[model samples]
Target chain A: MSDHKIDTHKIDTHKIDTHKIDKRDWDAHPPYVYPDYKSTTFRGPTKPLVPIAHTLSELTIPAFGHEQIQEFDNDLTINGRVDGEPQGERIQVSGRVLDEYGRPQIGTLVEIWQANAAGRYIHKTDQHDAPIDPNFFGGGRCVTDENGRYTFLSIKPGAYPWGNHHNAWRPNHIHFSLFGMSFASRLVTQMYFPGDPLLALDPIFNATADKIARESLVSKFSQKYSIPNIALGYEFDIVLRGPAATPMEA
Target chain B: MMSNKLKQTPSQTVGPFFSYALTPEQSGYNLKSIASPDMRADDTPGEHINLSGKIYDGNGEIVSDAMIEIWQTDADGNYLDRDTPPMDGTFTGFGRCDCEIKKEFYFNTVKPGPIEEGHAPHINMIVFMRGMLTHAYTRIYFSDESDANEKDAVFKSVPTERRHTIIANRVEEDNIVTYQFDLHMQGDNETVFFDV
Candidate 1:
């Protein structure tokens, strides 16, 4: 381990001055208590969320190095192979992680998990009645490059049924978890496939309210990144919250 | 290429299947987890303590699929940033634990110090689970630091009765210190969540 010492006395005064940064775009986010999503009824807090100022605790985050990710970490098609490939329509998902200011967020750790082509998760709790693909573990991780670009080679996830309501089926999607530069920059959201009919009926998808923000969750087909005779490609860029152009009252 | 100003991707539930990916080590995967519950190293200086808690839904059942993450300053009130190297390499001040099998989450880390003069020693926490439409943000303040807690600007913002919900109960057994802080998703004493 390197013996580099931190200067505890010299605090970042700039961060202290910019404590009143912009809050997240609440209009773009789903309300904590969207009644249509049944689970939110019991899980959502009854009181309003307490807004607090940004501090060193929110501005600084743990840095993950490139050494942590493995060769097949981002390739779901190969990571869990068991004598043969997983059965599904093979596809490639690529995107850039950027801040709201359009600046790339380098070295961000991006993680994804999804159901297999049969709409079944590898987890034991999933009782969707669909067959679980033995060769597909349905979990992958990748670190964004200097340009904030990341790609994953995997099978397209299938729509799955849930117990939320009678005959409830979730739109096909891949869960994404990202950790940007700070605690405030951390985000966990699902990426949906464009033009899926189920997106219209999914309560969770509609919870966001805004049409544009809801559409932002869907990834678009990209012929540019698609490999000939191998797999189709989809692009889903993520924009995390950025510091305000002008300070707001704390 | 998209426009410079872009809308953020909306948050979705973590659902019940993240353990295998986010906390792979605990889920029996060969892949290593990016962050673990243990954040302390032998050379790290501080009062080592075990912070453990269970997550409960409105029904009061243990949330087995919940994952809890924590970020805090070191014992000396210094947060880790890329620009400045940490005094202790092993103390990253970040940890992740999922309540999959045990129905509880635990972190073995040193107690964090106050980041500012009026602030109390606290650990920033986030809760992600299957039922939650979006992850919840909260903080863990030490009950022992009542003096600092009384003066904390953030802690003071919470309602008087609800303030106790964010403070962890301290216990010591056989020279080992432990802080117990349970999170209630709804009903009764629901944890005070922050928008920040």
Candidate 2:
């Protein structure tokens, strides 16, 4: 009903009317729909970390992940802690990209990155770096669409060494990054594996007290999609720091 | 002549940022929210979304398969069923979509209301894979004229230098608020994430 027009020079949203976007799964407990709130905060402008060289003209995509790109609920179902006690294959990652209020502008981009099967990076800065694999190239990136779905395929990384002390090696892990549509949503963090004994010894992994909370990043193995030994699957749901105070995007 | 084997000189994105992990201090933080395996995972309602865009890298190259995630408060500024306000029903707040996908990944969600917290409204976000980290957290806010984005607080606090990453541009034709979040590590402009 508003006079605002959609932005051009980009792909059109709402072009396909048939694709069914996922709905919010409410709690089974007592239902309580709260009152609606209107936000007054104005969106500020953001500059590109770099130049927008990949314009509408040239769009050359690099191959990533496996060939199977499926929906989270349809082909790839996520069974995280929300179900109470993650057992099978579950990864934890939470945060909100909103202000104190719940209103969130749509169309903001988000991305994540991590190590490969060998736990080595393409850079010399990585202290515990290892020999890079010839066939297995790890590392991927994605953006959020209108429905807020971002995805990428990465190899199941192996643990790496850190200190010379006996058994001072670290377990497998991944790094994360966020680009909010608003300053409120911007945030950065990491996901960790669960049930690893190194958690107690590794200083980086033990920065917190809630061991269960840190282990939320570890992905689980689902029998349905689990390949005997081909590959391991994981689903990590992330919540950006939104209108809530102490937003990370800034 | 002796044969020489060459090591694959991965792309520039193969920096230390991609190989980093979360320090223990970040447990309750952004990517560590569902840190515990006992939490419940809700299904983000599916609707219809016509989102489309080209992937790019730090040097501005098209980086395919960049996974993206969007989270926001519902039409009423309240998360879907988060609180048990005696007077209201349930309101759960959670939504996700991977842009690396195609038009099939669409949704028709209502514009959410401002929250009671008295701050500007916002949409929580997360980035999937970019050679950098596992999961990235951030926010998405709208310009003032939009109903759902006005009252957000986190959207206001950002310094002018960091505003663009927060608010998105609205496309009147599609009736959608759009913003492109280009995530970078150790770059000129980096995403601001929580330490949880």
Clashes (backbone N, CA, C under 3 Å), per candidate, total 0, 154
Model 2, native contacts kept: 0.01
Candidate models: Cα lDDT each: 0.84, 0.35
lDDT of 1 by residue, B106-143 (tens): 99999998887998999999998876777788999998
Top of the candidates by TM-score: 1
TM-score of 1: 0.92
The CAPRI class of candidate 2 is: incorrect
Q: What CAPRI grade goes to candidate 1?
A: acceptable
Please provide, for model 1 over A125-158, each residue's C-alpha lDDT reduced to its tens digit, 9 standing for 90 to 100. Answer: 7888899898999899899999889899999999
Q: Please list all clashing residue pairs in model 1, or write none if there are none.
A: none
What C-alpha lDDT, on a 0 to 100 scale, does residue B138 get in candidate 2?
Answer: 55
Clashes of 2: 154
Q: Best by lDDT, which number?
A: 1
Candidate 2 chain B worst ten-residue window by lDDT: B1-10
lDDT of 2 by residue, A1-250 (tens): 0111122223222331111211111121111111110000111112222221111011111111122222331111121123332122322222222211222324443334555456665333455546654433233334444444444434555677754255566566655555343322234545555566665665444433333334433444434333555435444444433321121221
